[model samples]
Target: MAPPTTGRLSALLRRCASAGALSPGAQLHAQALVAWRLPDVTLETDLVLFYCRCGALPHARQVFDTMTPSPSMHAYNVLLAASPPSAALGLLSRLLAAGLRPDRYAIPAALRACAELRDALLGAALHGFAVRLGLFSNVVVSGALLGMYAKAEVLDDAVRVFDEMPEKDTVVWNCMVTGYARAGRAKDALDLFWKAQVEAVNMVRDVRAVPSVLNICAKEGELMKGREIHGRMVRILAFDRDVAVGNALVDMYAKCGRVDGARAVFAGMKERNVVSWSTLISCYGVHGRGQEALRVYKEMVSQGVKPNCVTFTSILSSCSHSGLVTDGQRIFESMSKVYSVEPAADHYACMVDLMGRAGAIEEAVGFIRKMPMEPSASVWGALLSACAMHNNVDVGEIAAYRLFELEEGNASNYVTLCGIYDAAGRSDDVAGLRSRMRELGMVKTPGCSWVDVKGRACAFYQGSVPRYLRRRIVWVLDRLLEDMGGSESEDGHTNIYYDYELIRP
Candidate 1:
């Protein structure tokens, strides 16, 4: 006889799922099976659910597939939802071949799998199915639909689903906000956030806001608007003391060139996370203060705040900008052993940059080869740049070849290779690369830099004559470059001294 149903199994399942204890859940599932005899469909379904919730989709499928051939719609749904896009697609195709009709609950989860796989073609067919069954109006179904369109970058379709909704909730609002922000429609995202605020106040009496909304404002770089939102949070005490809100504020201020404001906010925070440390470090790195970034990193370490991948990336960027190659190598070496954090692609790219900027072209190339994963175009691009810096024409050629293979659509690779050839006085190679670029209809863009004077920002483009500049500025630069030209040039190469004069003046 089946053992009487009890809270023990249910509670254990919930705990294992919540904690991502997949192996333990499987063991408990085995125990539950032995604890009962002639287990009913409900118990089998519960077991399937345990594996699904634990993200052990393969195990879920094993249990679900072996169950009686006459599977419940819920069983099919679990399989469809638990599997990834490729797995889900194969399962759905098999289910159709078996002549089983999909239930309403199963369809949305399947659609979500399509979205995850970015299989927009399959997602479109699922949309039609939902519409034909009049299930498109279901709130959960509609939200999943919106997610699909958003992932596919089909803003119009997503907006249509959002518009057709009879009611909207914070989750729906968040989804749209995230979509617009990711699509680079920052202003539109900010507008939607405002609308969500008004809707919250009027329709939902118990509606509470989340810090993720503040993150949207930060992403848009509307500093003034973000400040106003922060003010609102303070007035209503809506996440005023939340760690995430504080972190968002710090990140916003730092990215907006108000690092002092960021520092002030960081000082006031009740608790600090690795993100908070990374944000400030990135600010210092961007401002060309590698030493200050390192100092802050030290303070974080002393306070027992572990440096995450982002924090290390920021510091690596600082090292690259300030030419701290040795320090960068130390951090890179310590990352895996000291912190036990596995290096991601970005970390590898930073290391390449560090070695490249320090004129360690060979070391950088070797690092790329030793990388466990395939080196991306950015990684090769960094090595290419380093080769150019050290005038390693042979290595530059190889790096350029790899980069071209990786990203044929981007024309920057050819241009960079041509410039390196020209710089090294390889006239024949330079001419050949230039002709190829012309054939491909690619043009090299001039380098440009911007500097803020008082409150205004001004740009200077390479090879472009400056106009309306103070006569004193032009006179000083003319003399400085002329003096440096005689002193700094070797053969035909010219190395100017504008960097020093600009700082001193």
Candidate 2:
């Protein structure tokens, strides 16, 4: 969110506020009061929040002091929310001592502070305060309490808080769902979603939480479940009115390897925005359909829905994946010239990947050199991967060493560089790299894979084989080692990154 701007005074005030230039800020405050006859609570509160963000709490209090004469509950909420955890609770105490009752806004802000601090004692006390004020049923206040307990990693307490609530809404459901997701309790989160569906607890009117459900189904490759939700939306509500739900469907169908389904959903959308176009382009990109993604992008431009940063990233990635170098370059160059969209780091990384994947290693290096900003790890990693593909040991070393500084603990960098050296028959260099890795206690990262079977999510971790696959694994165990160019260890597995690929939908 951006800070609110007031005509001419806000720009200067925003700068002074962010820089903690108290003298200049005071001047702006005086100018604001003189310029506008009515007191601008928004500008005053903005100054307080900016000051708090800059860690100039004393100056924030000075703004607060001026506000106290004609204070707004919104102003109090903004200040407390912006404040550091301990300081927020202290300010709440000061307000309570002055015989001022905390409103719903104030309670949530204070509870948020408790969440950040993980101060259970004060959290419980604030819960009592909220109860005394009869705000226990207030959705905002109850959501905050749930969030506070969840942040402390106390799901039991969070669930207890949820159960005791006399009312629940989309916000409460989302919080509980997010809490379960964060705690690695995906089953619990899914169960909660199903329970809410069965009870029809606001699901009929509020489809806000549907995207999260679709996201989970997509991640687990549960195409069946995603289709069920899509059907439910069609039957129970006018879901086509919202763009977000449509985007989620496109994403779900795309990740489930049902590109036609995604396209069909896109075609049937009654309303479309930039995000919808971007999601369609990304869906194509993921399935290695660069030409189709480019077609969609061109169609988006033709329809006057200008591409945003995300759209460019998706299209550029599609080009990279399918080796559409010419299209990728033209688009990257046009990003600033025609569209006025500044190429951010992701865009630059995509360019490098495009050139590198096309075996234009020198062009990729040149692109990095010409980048306005410092090359990110993605940029260098793209170069490194290309180097590995073309067996360009010299350039690979350069990218690898740069990555070493950028991501020190990533064992994959060392592994890639070592692979390059080994391929070049540089025995001494390989020994030296191995010795360095030993000195640094570096080891390869383990891999894991899993798939969804019906409604259940089955996970396979590193160094473990599924019992059902034991026979197949034994048959290929030796041949797999030979293909990977690594000798098998005593445990019947090669020294390779093995297991589950990330289930991104």
Candidate 3:
């Protein structure tokens, strides 16, 4: 039952390739020279592929160069595809100049390479080649071409290619949608989604399709539109929930100020992932419900959902808003010990804010010194705000000076420093900082807040609001206390102090 020597070597080489035993494979290749003979072109190609797969590019090239005959089109394509995208263009060009006819398999990768390089010229040439070779009918190759052109920001050409596609699949549509959105054409992308919905009822119901359009809607703040899309999704994917879709839904509602709706969707899901928890927790943080956000974090832990970097950011933000210093510290330490999540600059900023809010300026300073990374402007800004709150002129000066060093033109740093100095009655210091800010060409960003009232909305700037609305506010407050149950004070100030014995009189 002894096998022939030539077949035996081939089988051994294939086995090595299968098992990914690169060293043993090389040794076997060496043994083949003595034990059997030089392997056939097919076996040699397999060995080259095995080496390439094992990341032994040098050995693969050595095998390739020594091929008994020049390698076939397939061989060139494999090596070209395996090389890094940026470097692969040269290898592919060499293959083309050598008069090798790139087959259907080769075109997709070439298009992918062009996409990675953002080389629209090469990608267009490949697309034309695909058309001439009649491989343009293939969905995957066409999709790659669309994605490549989109990556290069050649949207018109990408769209032309897409329209020419006789059979557009979901992937092709998805690429165009994502491409348009990434190119900052949210309106155009949404129009495409609508077109897809009208043209293909099945695509509208597709889960992947839903998430892409929903993402666009989320970014554009089109809440009412997002609501309609969510309704359709609920009807279609009722029993089948996708984590991505749920996350997007949570984010959309949270961004639009419907935290309750977001929470409801989150609660109704039978399966909750880490993003889901993070989204809901962040919503609470944004809405100033730090306690509720903290509770959600604890609940996520109880359910064994691991926290990631984003999760820690949300947790720290919650602590900062609620002024929960002890809770923030406990969670920050546990990030490494329990959750195994490394703290990043964002987490450090939150920690500084938490400490600063609690008037623990010295502790915050000490914590910043121990940070594993350099303090970013955001971290310094938080500390400066805290110093302003606590009237700590000394530390405020230090933080402001550091901030000025980091970013000389940051007007907020100067404003915050001036606030601290002004509160301390350091008029000259305030004037100096303002002059310095002006010299640096730093202009203060205006502060504005939006208030919704009785089906109408208005925004108030730092120095002005609509005159009628301001008058109405005063009139309402004046009326609310006009008939109050109180005895007039004998002196100038109104006195509402309660004395039990006086009540008996």
Candidate 4:
């Protein structure tokens, strides 16, 4: 049989690559070699792309290196995109050495590789190269550069890139806003979002920006801002039906301690995906509504939605928090046997937590021994926490020893061990642990909580408040307590007040 024409073969290779048929792509490559002693550059490039798409980097390199004349910039870009960040940088260097000028396409691909690798130096060098080549202003290249800087957590550089860009397209704006959110500069992200709104940029048109801000609100516990964004989404008649947006909204509300709001969003969604289901189950789990979480999981399975690893993790977490040991164990086994989902370390950690929480100390230790892989810090931490809760000093010490070896710098592990010793009346051991911690210069991280008031977030730290604001804050709190019929204990700590109207004051 005669091989197809070059054009026909190129089309076939594209289809195989798109379909991710590695074996078929390799067979096609062999057939092309047999058909043409010296295939055209286009065919050769196509073969490289096919191999790259199939993750056959070695074959891609072979095709690239064996080309009679050096490959085109397009070929280099394809290889760069296929390679890891370091390899991509190496390819860019080779392109420069070969006297091939990188065009708009090649520069952005290399920048993206740098971003993923978080190599700030390499990314900055690529930015310089793009500027020298006069390709920096290209919309795509500028967007990639901004994203690279953002991923590297060089927010100032990202802002500079944004400010210098001659044209600010929606993609550019989205990148900057998302970057600020990811860097925990939530105010900056919200400011930019409102700025975009004032400029009438139709932010809802950029589907990516909404989720980024929603995530920021979630992290900062800014429920007011989150609801405002949700209202905007509804007004625009946008993202109400988008599964990703819906999932984000649900997560935001859940993280803010508003399970009812999250549940409302979940219930109102016209369509739901695995993420939507998982987020809702996670919400219930976190709020200690384990039975409700398990119910949702069953409903998801009944609706034919396939649960992924995250879904299992959430459900297992629910079981652990709810003290449903038997249920957790059943689900853990079913993950591999019934669902064919291999239990990752997280799943094992959850299982250990479940056993520990249920006071099965010996079983939990035995479970760790039976794991296919080495137990991680989380696994040991779970055991240690259980020991503290149950006053099991022996097991607690063992878990603490493993934890100290695993996470030497985590002061919380040492603190937890000290607490266990104190509870067991082992003052000597507790003092020794504290002395060791002090010698090692370890300090416990301060506990902090955040509340959103009138669209602003206020973070409060344990045992500390700014002296300047202390008087005014105390006066306001006194008024709030008076209004709520609250009384102070002998130690001057306020007793619980069920009325939430105190928040309004």
* Best-matching candidate per TM-score: 4
The regions of model 4 sitting more than 4 angstroms off are 1-63, 77-87, 200-202, 453-457, 465-505
Model 3 per-residue lDDT tens digits across residues 377-462: 88998999999999999999999999989987678888888999999999999998888877778889777655446534476665
lDDT of 4 by residue, 231-269 (tens): 988877665677788999999999988888899999988
Measured by lDDT, the strongest candidate is 4
Segments in model 3 whose C-alpha atoms lie over 4 Å from true places: 2-39, 44-66, 117-139, 153-157, 163-166, 238-240, 421-438, 444-505
* Per-model C-alpha RMSD: 7.8, 10.5, 8.6, 5.9
Q: In model 2, what is the error at residue 417, expressed in angstroms?
A: 1.6
Local distance difference test values of all predictions, in order: 0.76, 0.82, 0.81, 0.87
The residue pairs that clash in candidate 4, if any, are: none
> How many Å off is the CA of 446 in candidate 1?
5.6
Q: Clash pairs of candidate 2?
A: 448-499, 448-500, 449-500
For candidate 1, the per-residue lDDT at 279 reads 86
Q: 3 or 4: which has the higher TM-score? A: 4
Rank candidates by lDDT, best first: 4, 2, 3, 1
Q: Model 1: how far is 407 from its true place, Å?
A: 5.0
lDDT of 4: 0.87
